[model samples]
Structure formats: structure tokens, C-alpha cells
Target: MVLAFSTESLNGLCSDDQLELLDAIDHLRLQGIDHYISLPQIIVCGDQSSGKSSVLEAISGVPFPVKSNLCTCFPTELVLRRTPETGVTVSIVPDSSYNSTENGLHKFHEELDGFEGFPDLVEKAKVAMGITTLGKAFSKDRLRVEITGPDRPHLTIIDMPGLIHSETKTQSKTDVRLVRQVVRSYMKQPRSIILAVVSAKNDFANQAVLNFAREVDERGSRTMGVITKPDCLVEGSGSEKAFISLARNNQVNFDLGWHVLKNLDSETQKGSSLLNQRNVEEARFFSRGAWKELPPSMLGINELRKRLSDVLLKQIAFELPSLIREIESGLDESREKLKELGEPRRTYDEQRLQLLQVSQGFQSLVEGSVSGSYDDPFFEDAQSDKGYEQRIRSVIQNMNKEFADEITAHGHRREVGSKSQTPDQNPEYVTREVFLDHVQSMMQRTRGQELPGIFSPLVVADLFRQQSSPWEEIARGHVKKAWDSAVKFLELVIEHVADPSISNSLLEKVIRPALKTLLTDAEVKTAELLKSHHRVHPITYNQEYAETIHFPGSHSREEISNIVRSFFGLSSISNGNQYLNNNNYNLSRLVDNLSKRVEPTTERLAASEALDRMLAYYYIALKRFIDGIAIEVIEQKILVPLSDILSPVAVFKMPAKVADLIAGESWESRSKRQDLTKKIDVLREGLGTCERFVSSRLKDEQNSQQEEAAGEDLDTSDLSVGIPTASDTEEAGVV
Candidate 1:
């Protein structure tokens, strides 16, 4: 019952140019290329009753249990290899549902004494595949038939389930979709060369094989049409003319072209041996009649086998590099998935190391954000203008510019003197007239003074108060914007460096509270800074303000005085009037003006000066605040504190159950990791096999070139490189 592969030498399997290439591909498959995807091979396809099984049987020289619908239900992968002795071995790659019953089923491989064993093998396969009930349902699982003999050609062809057009007793509506799906799956592989089988007995247009082939191979570039039962066509009938036209490459011209094979007629099929069928095929079909007129290469199963061997060799050679690239691509993706699954973190020591790595990485990322040295891959392609500190500074700078514009445009004076208007009308608005009235009212209240001309510090203080009341709210807006940016940056760092559970814990336990404290402190300090500047009567003044008042063309003091007076809408005065006004006697005029008619002009000047100083100080203060938030508030409070919170000690102090939860892999991830690991191994093995074959081919080509250069006669009998010789049969193999 045992049909194990005998330990006969298969080294010469690569002796012939065609066999060498085919053996290489077979080796790749044996290395498990299918686990990743489809591999390069010939896929035989046709509709039911299309003589597909006959063509396959002729090519492999094995009786494949050919029948009406029995043998075509499941895919049969025929693996043919040359041997010193003749034998057939059958095995099943069962479906998952049958796995329990077929456990250790490699022992199911059985040696066949004669063609009679095929029918029994077919019944066994049907039963094992769960199609024995009505036996019309199909299976996608492959029943591999390995045949080794002196007569067999070195080949591997997947004979797919025949395309179904209608349902049978055991078939349902779903069977039509299932059969077509299975057939198309093999045909759609770019590496699969389709052998589209069509019966010459049937109308050419009625066969679905050509249509299915065209679905996946639109150009017919890799599709070779095999017209079986050519004897069924009457010699001079319209069918013969049409088939002749097809054979002559006249109708539906395929790139690989059409081939005709004359199989045994129904009467002769029962008693004829495959050897006799192959002999009769050449003797009766190719010797005379319309088939005689066809090119010798386009007739018979032998020629088709030779053509397929050549075409498949070219295909495998062409697709080898691309196949290697695909496998390498898959390998890289698998490795990344394995990386995401990460190292096992079940033990205390493992958890400590894992947490430490996360802490170091997160700390480095946050520090990089502060220093503007972003080397992390996660930070790549982030908005160029949105560096952590740059974002905060940009917001504050924009707000400061808007605040300065608001002060200059509408904060110069107030409308307090108008009885028709009240502060309640626009609580946040102030105009020059209202501001001037307020200043005048304050001056009147403090007028019991040292002298009539003396200016009180209280008036300066009152003016400062009304103008800068809007500062607190504007500053608060800027603070909120900066704080939001800081939180976003922190989250980005954590997400890049740590697991999700660890990130959430750090955000809750360390970063959020620290950010809250720092933000509150920033708000309080901001208000205090603004209030301190308003407490004194112009305690600090920079010459930058006085220097701001010069007119472009002014020269002497008289000219400068005229420019200043004009700017304030004062009446024009000559140089002599300006000289008299420069005397100490002018103090009474100035005091008179400040108390009454010119009070509005005086307030405008004072308000303008106050706005300029406030902006200057704010520009400096905004820079300090951005630096403190990004570097101190966030860096020192939130980001810096995260190190200890995410430290080994903190992770250890956490309940063992919680730590396990944080480090545990999800079921999906674990499954994916194992699956990818298996896939990567399979792909690497396939890649290695193909690489060796390609390298071998290269070496052979180079050797041929060297021989030509040396003027040595090339052996005509050697055939093409990688094509085996008849003499190679001396080396036996069990495939």
C-alpha cells in the first residue's frame, strides 16, 4: 500500500533545458510557494465534456479516472517526472473539515498496479472530500497524482474543476459560482499559462473555456488553445472549415496559437492503452487528411507538450525576478507585523525592560520637540510651521499683533463725557473722548494738590487702568491656545513611543495633572505682571518711545515742535512763538490745556505712549511665555514627570494583573504573528529556490558563451540549456 518516493537520484532532473526549468519550478512549489500565492505553472481549463481530462491523460501518460462528471469535480494536479521504472502514486491534500479523520494521512499515498487503481482512487478521493453523497458537488482541494515513468514528460499541470453551465442532481445554484471561482482562481495568476481546452465536436462559440481564458488573459498572450477530438469534425463540412481556419491561425488568433489533438474515439477508448493512443494520435491524425495540412508543430499531444515545456520555461525565467521581489516584499511586511506584536512581556524583568525602553523613547521624543531637533520617524512630514515652540509662539505673536492693532485703532480714547452714551452700551469698548473725560474727572477729584501745574501720579495710574483692562482676556486666550498645542504634542510623543494602555495611563496619571498646575500658575503670573506695570506712574521708560516721535524732515527744535503741534491738530506757530513757548512761562498754558479744551489731545498722546510700551513688553513677555510652556511648563512639568511615571519602578508598583494587561498581546495580533511567521518562512524558501535556479541558468549561459569564444563546436544533441536528453532516463527518480 505504501507509495513513498523512493530514494533514487533526481540530480539529473535539471539535466535538460526544459526539464531543468520545470524541475526548478517544481522544487519551488515543494518548498511551499503556494502558501504565499500562486506560482508559475500550466493551468488546464475547459467546460464540462470539453475533452479536458483526455488531453491531461495524454500529456501525463496516466489514466486519470476520466468520466462524464466524476473526475472533473475536484482539481487534479498532475506531477509528471522522468523515471527509470514506471509507476503511479496518488495522495490527497484534504480539506480542513476532513483533517481529524485524515490525520497523519501522508500514509494514504498508494502505489497503483494498473489503470484499475485510478477508479478506486477517484472514489476514495470523493468520499474523503465529502462529495460522495450525491457526488456532483465540487471541492477546491487538490488530489495530487504523481507519475514517474520512462514515457512521461517532465511537467506539472493543474487540471482545474471543469466550468459548469447548469446545476445537476447534487449541484445547487452555488456550485456554478464555486466551480467558476475555482477555475478563475488558477487562471488569474499572472504566472499561470492557461491551457484552454475546447472540443472540436462542439460549436467553438459555445465553449466557455475561451471566454474564461479571455477574462484573465485578455490578450491571449499566455493562453494556448487546445482543440481536442479533431477527428469528430467531418472532412469537408463547415465545422471542418471553421476548425481548419482556427488551426491555421485564421479565426480567434491566439499569440501562443491553437493546437489540435486527436484522442481515442469512444469505441476504442475502453481497450486502448495510453501508449497506443499516443501512437495512433500521431499515426492516424498527423499522417493524412485536413490535419495533414496543418503545421507539424500545431498538431498532436506530443508537440503540445514540447511547446508547453518551452513556453513554461520562458515564463518561469521571465517571472523569476518578479516572483523573488514579491516574496521579499511579503517577508518585509511579515517582519514589520512581528515587530508590532513585539517581544514577550510576561515576566517582571521583561516588563521592567519594556517600560524603561518606552520611557527613554518618549523622553527623547518630547525633548526633541522642545529643542527643534526632530530625528524621530514619527515626526517626519509633520507640518513644517508647526514645531512645538513655533506653534505656541506663532499663536501668541498673532494675538499680540491683533491686540496692538485693537489698541491703536479703537482704544485711544473713551466716550465718558456724552450723557447720551453709557458704559453699559458697549462694556468692552472705549473711545478717545470717553477716556479723556474719565482722565479729566480723575484729575478734578485729586486737584487739591501741591501746585496748580503739578501732574498727579493718580491720573497716570487711572489712564493705565482703563487702557489695559482688555489685556487679561487676550492673554488668557493666548494661554489656552499654547496649552492645547502642548497637550497635542505630548499625546503625539506618547503614541509614537508607548503601547496604547501605557499612553492612556501616563496621560491620566502624570501629564494631565502637571499640565493643569502649570497652566494655572501661568495664568496667575500673567495677571500679576500686567497689574504691576499699571501700579506706578511711568516708572520705566525706554528712549525707543521718544525716538518714535521725530518727523522725517524736521531739523531744529522749532521745526520739531511744529511737527508735534501739527500732529496734535494745534494751531501753526512760527519759530519766534515756538521760542517763547519753550520758556518756563508756558507751564501755565500747558496746565490750562490739560484741565480743559486740549485734554482730549493730551489723553490721545498718553494713550498712544501706553499702547506702545504695552506692546513692547508683551512682545518680550510672549517669547518668555512660549519658552516657558514648551521648555518649562510642558517639558519640566508634564514631559519630564512622565519619565518617573513610566519608569520601571512605577510599572513594577502597578498590580501584576494590570501590568500583564498592558503588556499582553491581543488574540488577533498573536494569530497574525504566527501566520506571518509561517508565510515569511515559506516565501524565503521559495525565493532561495528561484535564486539558485536563476543563478544556475546564468552560469550555463556564460559557459556557452565561453565555449563559443574558444571556437569549440557546440553539441547539437545537447538541445537547449536546461532541456533534458533521452539518455537522462538512465538516472531514475521517484516523484
Candidate 2:
């Protein structure tokens, strides 16, 4: 299975320095770095039965089984390495979709001294992947074959299952979708170079792989077109000329350009020495046909090997800096996850210490929120819903403002007059005349042995109690709102500081009961504040009460006299002088006139005065109630108690058994920690590999510059000579 090309020619395809670069990346891939970060490699994709396997065989000298039907069912990675001895190591890298115990796929491995067992090895891999006996038509598992020989080119090429157009009985629609998904996944890797293979025997426009390649590599910068089976076309025919045009990079131009490879036909599949014979036939067919018009470097497998090697090397060099950064970022993420999972807590003392640490962190955050000292990163985005919820003081302040507005707007049972700026549209509003009539009736019913112009204090107290009835409900609601906010903020803090298992237990056992008790106290305090206004008589020491009581408008003497006469049913008396003459007025007559005259006037005056006093006292008490509820119930009872509910001191006071019950690690937590530790170790190793590669690359560049300065001219035309440095890559606008 040796290649037709000589050892010297193969060595010239890629330099030792370039091979070392590929080796570094390949080493990381073998370590499973690809699961975390995409690496630079070449992926060969084509439509079914497009001679894709034949092209791969001609290039790598591995005898891929070529048949009339589809041959490859899964992706195969060919890792070609240059070594003094020839050997092959085949292993199955299980897909992340499957567990290690799935059909024992993870245990599949084999070694051989040559390529004779490769086909048999592939069959064994399919069996291991459950594709042979089980009804599974395709698998995401990759068959990785590391081939080492003196003449092999240093390259890693992945041959994906050929893209299918429709579903047959053997290949269901699920198979078609799975194959497409698998191919797209590899192509979507930003660093992969796509080798899109199409057959000249079929219509080039109908090939699906070209469309897929264009979708992922829009500018064609990373895609190279490979036209196989050029011998299928008739010489000098239109199809031949068309494919010749395509081969010349004119019909379907790619930035990496197109390459023509002639693969073995069906008749040649049964023969020995296929690689040697295939090469000789490919040279003969292209040398005489219209393909001869193209450059020698774009027509054969020999140049293709060199081209692939150079492209892979350049891609690695271009992407190395970013790759290193990605690895470092992944490493940091793994470390942070491990830190969150924390060390294992298997004993009572260990669990207690962990719980105490979590409590201290939670208390620090809660205290910061309650005090409005939001310096932590958790409080960064204050405009988002979660961010606003985390800042307890700000949220409470907003809620308090809303509560005050509600009390001011809706606290009164009656809006007594048109003096209200925005008249109350509610059913409780009553006009001044109507309200005064009701008050006069009430006074009459409750009249005591007071003088005519006096009304009992009990009437005013009854009106005040009814007017202030809405206060208790509004205040109670405000207290409950604040309590709910505090509870939410505490829950968020616990989630941030403790592991899930510990946080859930602590909330159910300790934090929730304390919050409930605090809420009850807040509600009770609010009720007490309202009761003071409800049950007691209206009283205020402020001098504003006197200022607030004044006659609503001027009253003329004629109006008063008419009102008196109408109520007393008396005939008109002489104007002013008759009543003023003391001699003419007898004592009995004067007393009767005086009693009737004051009765009507007394009732009207008493009602007006009562309305004024009730309004004044209502406003004074309204201000006091708003302030008391905001400060005493919400701030003191609910918010201020939040920091102490889960403080370190509380944890210290808890019994050892309680601490163990609340903080014991679950099986899931322990398993996650172990997994994260393993991932962190791998990421650290990956970072080291990337850094060393970059360092060596820099040293090589410096050495090259020094060599050039010493009168040694390097070949500037060579593809390897122009690999962009890190700075050059940035200047070229590579991300």
C-alpha cells in the first residue's frame, strides 16, 4: 500500500518544522481538546458514489473499500505522520452523544504493522459502534487511524460520510439528516479547511457539497474544490470542456482554487498495485486532454498533497494566537466551576465549615443590598429585572413611593367637597351640601343636654373613623410587598453563594421559616399603626387646626334673618329698632324670640364647623401614617432583618447535626466536582501546548530573519514562506 511518489518527494511536501506544528495540534486533539475548542484540520466532503473514497485512496495510499453503493457510514480521521517505521493504530473516539458503556464502543482499539487489516478494522469499529447488528444506520463516532511511515506526509484529513440527496429503504430520512448534520458540524468549525469533492461525471451544479461548502465558507477562503473522475467525460465534448473550465478555476472559482484528481474506475477496483497504476493512468489522461492546458500543480495528487500540507500549516499559524486565547478562557471557566462546586464535604465538621463560609458570603451580599452599598458585580446591571430585584434598598424605596401615593389618593372613605384638585370619581365621594345634611341629622339623633349652639364631640369622632377606614388595607399591603421583595433577594443571594444541594436544604430548613416570622411581625406592626388612627378619638397638637377652621364664605344679615323666620314660623318684626328698645321688650317675650331664633342658626353653624375639623385632622394623620409604615414596618421589621437571617453567627449557633443535614454534599455535586477537576487538568495541558507552539513559531521566525541577514536568501515564492505572523493576522483582520 505504498504511495507511487518517492520518499524525497514526500519529504519535500512538508518541512520538519511544519510537521512539528501539525504534531502539536494533533497531540491536543488526541487529548480531546477538540471537545472544548475547534482545531484546524482538513475535512473531505462529497456526494454519495462520487469516487470520494477512490480520491482518498490515491492521496493517502490507504485502501479504502470502493463499491457501487455507499461505503463510508461514519467519519474517519486519517492522521499521517512521518516516522522511521511503518505502523497503524486504529481506535474509536466515542461521540459525546453516547456514554462510555454504550455497547463497549470506548473499548475498541487495535494495532497493525501495515495497512492490510484496515478494512477489517473498520468493520470491527462499525460493530463496536452498534451500526452492524443494531438497526442504527449511522453513528456520530469517529474512527481515528494514526498511520506512521517514512514516506507519509505529515497531515490530518477527515473523510466524512458522503452527503445524501434522498432517503431509500436502507437509508431512512433520519440517516440523511444525521449525515448532513455530521458534515455541517465539521464544516462549521471556523478553522477547518473544506476539501469539497465533486465528480466530473455528474452535473457540477447539482452537487450538494459545493452548496454546503459555500454556506459555511461564504467567501471560499477556506474551501478548495477537488474534481474527481475527470476521465468519465468524453474528450472534446461540451461536458469535457465545461469540466476543463471548472478545473481551471473559471466556472466555480474558490479562493484556495480547484484541483483535478483522476481516481480508479470500477474495473480497476479488483486489481493490485492500484495506487501506482492509478497515478500512471491519471497522468496519461490529463496530459493529452484539454486538462493539459491547466498548470501542472493543479492537475494531480502529488501537487494536491503539497497544497493540503501548506494550507493546513498556514491555517494553524493564522489561528494559533486565537486558539491559545480560547484555551486560556476555557481553563479559567473550568477553574471557576470547580471553585463553585467547592471541596468535598464528607464529615460533619467539613460540612459545617462549608455552610459557615456560604453564610458569610450570603450575609455580605444581603447587607450590601439593604444598606444600598452596591459595589459587588452581582449588582452590576441595575436596569434588568434580576439586577433590580437584587438591590433591596432601591426596590423598597420605589415600593414606598408607590405606597405613599396610594394612601394619599385612596385613603379617605369620603371626598367631602369640590375642593379636591382631581375630584374623586369613586362611589365614596359626596358633595359639601349633601354631607352637611347627613351630619345635621346625626347631631339631632345624638343630642345631649348641651346648649343650642354646641354639638357633641362624639359626632366628629364617628366621622373621622369612617373617613380613615381605607388606611389599614393600604398599609398592610405595602408591608407585604416589602416582605416579598426581601425574601426574593435573600433567595438570590443563597443561590449565588452556595451549591444547589446546600442552598435548597438551607432555604427549606432555616431561611424560609425566619422570613415567615419576620413577615408576620411586619404585618402585625402595620395593623397596630392603623389601630391607633381607627379606634382613638381624633386629636392633634398642631396649631394648623385653628388656621384651617374658617367660615367658607361671607353671610349677609338678610340671609340669616330669612333662615331664622322660615324655621321659627314667625311673622315679620320691625326692622332693628323695635328689638333694640329694652322698655318695650318684656322678659318673657324676649326669651321666647331668642330661643326660636338661635335654634335653626345653631344647627347650621355646628355642621359647617364639624366638616372643617374633620378634613384638617384627616390630612395630619395621613402624613403621620405614611411615615410610620415606611420606617417601622417595612424598613425596620422586614428589610433590616434580612442580613441576620443567614449570617455567619447564625450558622455558628446551629447544632452540628443541623449543619450536617443542611450542608451535606449530594451525589450529583460530588460527581460534578470530579468531572470539572478532570476537565480543568486537560484544559491546563492544552494551554501549555498552545503556548509552546506559539513560542517555537516565534523563535523560528527570528531564526529565519537572522539567516536571511547572513546572506542566505529564502524562497519568498514558496507557500510556507508567507505564513502570517500574529500581528500580520490581526492587521489582515482575522478575529
Candidate 3:
């Protein structure tokens, strides 16, 4: 499909079916249907000084304002309709974003008797679009000029801002970016058919239209190249060769192919009438030696319209289903947003209900989190990397396990030191000289105060104090970690369940204060629990101590009895007497060996029993402390009080300002809700129309195919009314 014209051309013979479809599409455009659902359309784009305005004037039969210095700064959507009367009107149709600014300024319009007043109207449009100062600026707002004439085609074309290369006094870098953004916005629409106009005078190297078109419409499937000013090419030059190559599709291939339209040159346009411009175009196409051999269908403005109409119809047929889908998707998204915003907040009762709902939801979340149910959505959201492990019950359970392990490990710290064997080899350990030294020190301090073998109460108290010194630090850390986790969980629950309107205030006025109080109370209670353990320095005997101290055999009893008697000097053992009588025995050396070996061993074994008794009782008390804090301090003081205090603060009495905020929607939110509702209606309506159109078109095509297969006459009853068998503008003139 290189589209090289043949000797004979297919001109003025396009089917009435194609023209009818274009007319129906134009009817929808006249109703402003594209604002709701994007329809397949022809959008003309080119660079500055690319003969874009000339081409538009030739195709549209309207004299657009063509300035030598400035390009059109806004999109101009020209909707041409063929009617019995001849008239034109220009109006500004702001985009959806401007719906709230529906003042008279945005709705301004002017009727025109002819093209004589159009240039001034364009200037006015510039000012209305906020380009009041002498600067290069553009707008996304559309200036729609509807022309109803006996000579107009049933077509809609949008003329976008021409791409600029560099900055000048009026146009800065911002203007360059602004133009590209504006043009790309239109070109990027999936349903837009890009009419990329390039001039034959410039080398294709400088033409950016082709590059932009390729960027958005890769493969050039929906882009049609319109080569204007073909007569401007010099004879026998590199530029001439490039123009011919593009026109012949030998370079830069396009699916729709290149179309060479010889519009009236500037000199010719000055003297020629709008009707005579066509005559001039035809004369040049036929008389020019370079273009004379090409097919008439591939030249001139008249054929371009017919070709565009055919292409637009086919495109509409192809994209209708997707357009419906897009519209439906938008509708669904709007509904979801409106749902999240909840029912309109307007009255006191409504506000009260909203607050109550939030409170109830928060309560449910807190309860679920502590109980580990995770039934509520808040906990469900917490099932992620961000401290999901910090759930109330989960954190407490893990901390308790870690605490028990820590305490168990601490009990064996002495045995695992450098001098001792591993616990697996033997669990028995001698506290030995450490306790003996403490008792001796106590005896020296309590001289003349206690009888022999009887420890002063002060000795027991000092030993207990030294052993239990680490409890306060450990208890404080445990309470703080658990409290912090509870507070964090509370914040998460509030954020998840409560509306933004109340979350901040509730946290400030209710949750934070109550949580602080609970933390204070828990800290005090924890200190007291550890203090109680330290206060009762009881040295009472117990069955566990007896079990810890008893030796299992008669040999252990006799050995212990001998060591006590020998060390106490109540008697020398018989073996020692036998060694003393031997001539090899030295009495002083024997005495030194007995004092070093025998006495320390006896004292060590006894000290080990006392140490074992003390630690056994201490370990039991530590286990009780861990359990008591978890139950009484963390759960009872912190977790329970947090929930109880928050309920009263959040549910019972809200501030007057907060009540008003919850009861009523903000102006911005109300505007957004209204806008969405309106757009939803528009989208739904457009979707219905497109659905019906597609259904009818498919049914007609099916019937036509069936009739041909069955050898019967085609049915044309369901199609639109057929137009006159003449040129589109000529048909308009006939009326």
C-alpha cells in the first residue's frame, strides 16, 4: 500500500456509506461527545512555519489566523456541519477541570457572518485563554468554532500548537516545553489519527513532526503524512530528491502513505476566492510536470477530505469497543472513590453517626489485635514488613520467651567462665570462696555481734542485694519495649479505622494522654514488683535446699565427716599419725599440705551447698516476677487501660469543631464529588451510544454478508441517510 498514484484516480466516487458514517460521527462531535469518551479523530500537527495553517485553510475552507511571528497558543477544535443555512459561531469549551469556574467569561462566544472576523476572534481567544500579556503561552482549554454552511463538510479537526525549535524574546525555554507538551497531549491520545504535515522546502532532517509521530504512533499505523508546498522544492537538488523519495514512499514509510497537497501559495491565496482556491489547486496538480503523472486521488484538497473521511470511518469502527471499555472503566473508578468518601456529611445526626462508626471500628480493631484474632481490616493491613510482629499478644509472648531464656542463661554464667568445665560435663558448680569471703567479711564487720556459725541478718541482706542488682534495669527495659509496642499498635489501629478528620485530634486529646498515663503507671508498678523481691531477704531453710545439699551415698557421708573433723582440728586422722611416725615425713610440710588442701576442700564443698540453695530460690522468684509483670503490669495496667481510656475519650465527647468537620464535607471535596458524578453520567451516556452504534453496525455488516452469500440483495435500511453523489462542499452548496 505505497499509495503511488496510477494514471486514473478514484475521485468523487467514495461510497455514500463512508460519507454517512462520517456525518454521524460529526453529529456526535457537535454534541460535545468526545469530552466524555475519546473518539477516533483527525488531529493536525506540524512544526512552526511548516505551512500548517495554509493546509488547514485549504481543507477546512476557513481562513484561520496565520501570523508570521506567533503560532496558535491553544487547541482549536473546528466542527464543520452541513446545513440548509450559512452561519458560524465561535465559543470556548473549557475542559472538565474548569467546570467549577463556570462564569460568563468561560462561556463567552461570538457569531460570525464570514471569515472576515475570524482573525480578531482568534486574538480574543488568546486573551480569554489567559495569554493576556505579550508572551508565548498555551492552554489545554479548547476553542471550539462551529460552522454551519451549505458548503461545509461534516467533519471535525483539531489544530494543535506548532512545534518550535528555539527561544526568542517572546518565546523562552518554557514556551518550547509548553508547545511540546501541548502537542504531545493530543498526539498521545490512542484514538487520534495524527495528520503530520511536513513541508517539501526543508530537508526531512529538520522536520520534527515525523519524529513526534513515530514516538507516539510507532510503525506510523495511524499517522498520515501531509506534504505541503511541493512547488517550493528546487529543481535537481538534494532536497528535491528527498521530497520525491518521501512522496514515493521510498524513505520514511507510513501505513496511510504520504499525501502531496498543492495548496495555494501565499501570493496566489491573496487574490483567490475560497471557491477559486480549489480551481487553482486542481490547475496546479494537472499542469505541474512533476505531479501531472500522479493519480488525482493522491493529490489536491478534495481527495484528501474523501480519503480522511474513509479512514476516520474505518478507525471509528475499529475503536468503538475500546472506547466503550475506557468509559466504563472510568465510571467504575469514580464510583469507588465516591464510595470511599462515604455518604455526604451534612447534618448533626449524620456527623454523630460517622463518629460512632469510626469509634466502633477502632474498638473492634484494638480488641482483635490484642486477642490475636486479626479479624479486623486494621490487623489485616498489619500483616506486612512494617512491625506486623509488634502485635500486642505476639510481642508479649515473644518477649516472655526471650526473658525466660535470658534468666536461665544467667544462672549458668558462673559455671561457663574460664575456670569451669562445660555445663553438659557437669551441672554442679562451687560458688566456693566468693560466698565464703562475703560471709567472712560480714563476720569481721559484725564482730562481737553474732555467735559462731550463725550469720547476721545483714550478711543475708547484702548477699541478696548484690545478686539481685540487675533486676531493675532488666525490668525497666522489658516494660518499655512492651509499652512502646502497645502504643505503636494503637496508632496503627487508629489510622486504619478512624477517618482523617478525627484521627489527629483523638490521638492528641485522648489516646496519647491516656497512653502516657498508663506508661507512668506501669513503670511505677514494675519498679514496685522488683522492689518487693529485693525487700524480702529471707534466709529460711526449705526442702529444695535439703535436696540440693544432700550427698547420695554412705561413702560421700564418711568422706565429708573425716574432712570436717580434720579441718576443725578436733582430731588428726589415723593416716596422718602413721605418716608423722615415718622418718621420711616432715611435720611442717605435712601441716602446710593439710591446711592448703584439706581445709579449703571442706570449706568449698559446704559453700557450694549454700550457693546452690540461694540461686535455686532466686531462680524461682525470677520466674514468678516474669509472670507477674506480664499479667499485672503489661496486660492489666497498659493494654487494658489503653483500650478503656480510649473508648471514653474517642466515643463520648468530640470537640464542636471536630463534630462540624465530620458532619460536613469540605468545599473542595464537595466540588470533586459533584464533578465526578457529572462526568460519570456523561461517560455512561456516551458508552451507551457507542454500544448501540457498534451493535447496529455489526448487525448490518452481518446481514449484508449473509445476503451476498445467499445470492440475495443487500439491505441498506439500517444505515444512515445517504448524501448526494457530489463533492462534500458542493453538496452543501446545493442546499
Top candidate, metric lDDT: 2
| Clashing residue pairs found in predicted model 3 | 150-732
Kindly provide the TM-score of model 2 when superposed on the true structure, using C-alpha atoms. Answer: 0.66
Report model 1's TM-score to 2 decimal places. 0.66
Return the candidate ranking by TM-score, descending.
Answer: 3, 2, 1
Q: Each prediction's Cα lDDT score?
A: 0.63, 0.79, 0.66
Question: Which pairs of residues have clashing backbones in candidate 2?
Answer: none
Q: Estimate each model's TM-score.
A: 0.66, 0.66, 0.68
lDDT of 1 by residue, 1-735 (tens): 122222221222223535666767787776667747668787889988787877766665544544545578788887776678777778876543444344554446777755456667767877776676656488877788877777455668788887888887667778988888878877898889898988888888888888888888888889999888877778889998898888776877689999988776543554324445464656576788877888888887667766876677667656666676777788898888777666766576676677667777766665555555656675655456444333333444454566445434333233222334445332344454554455556666765553544446556556556555555565566556656766776777767787665567667766677677767766665555555655544453445434543321112234445555666566753333334445533432443334332223554444443333434443343344344434443344433443354445665576756555565555665566667777888888877776676666556666777898999988745445333222221131101
- Lowest lDDT sum, 10 consecutive residues, model 3, at 1-10
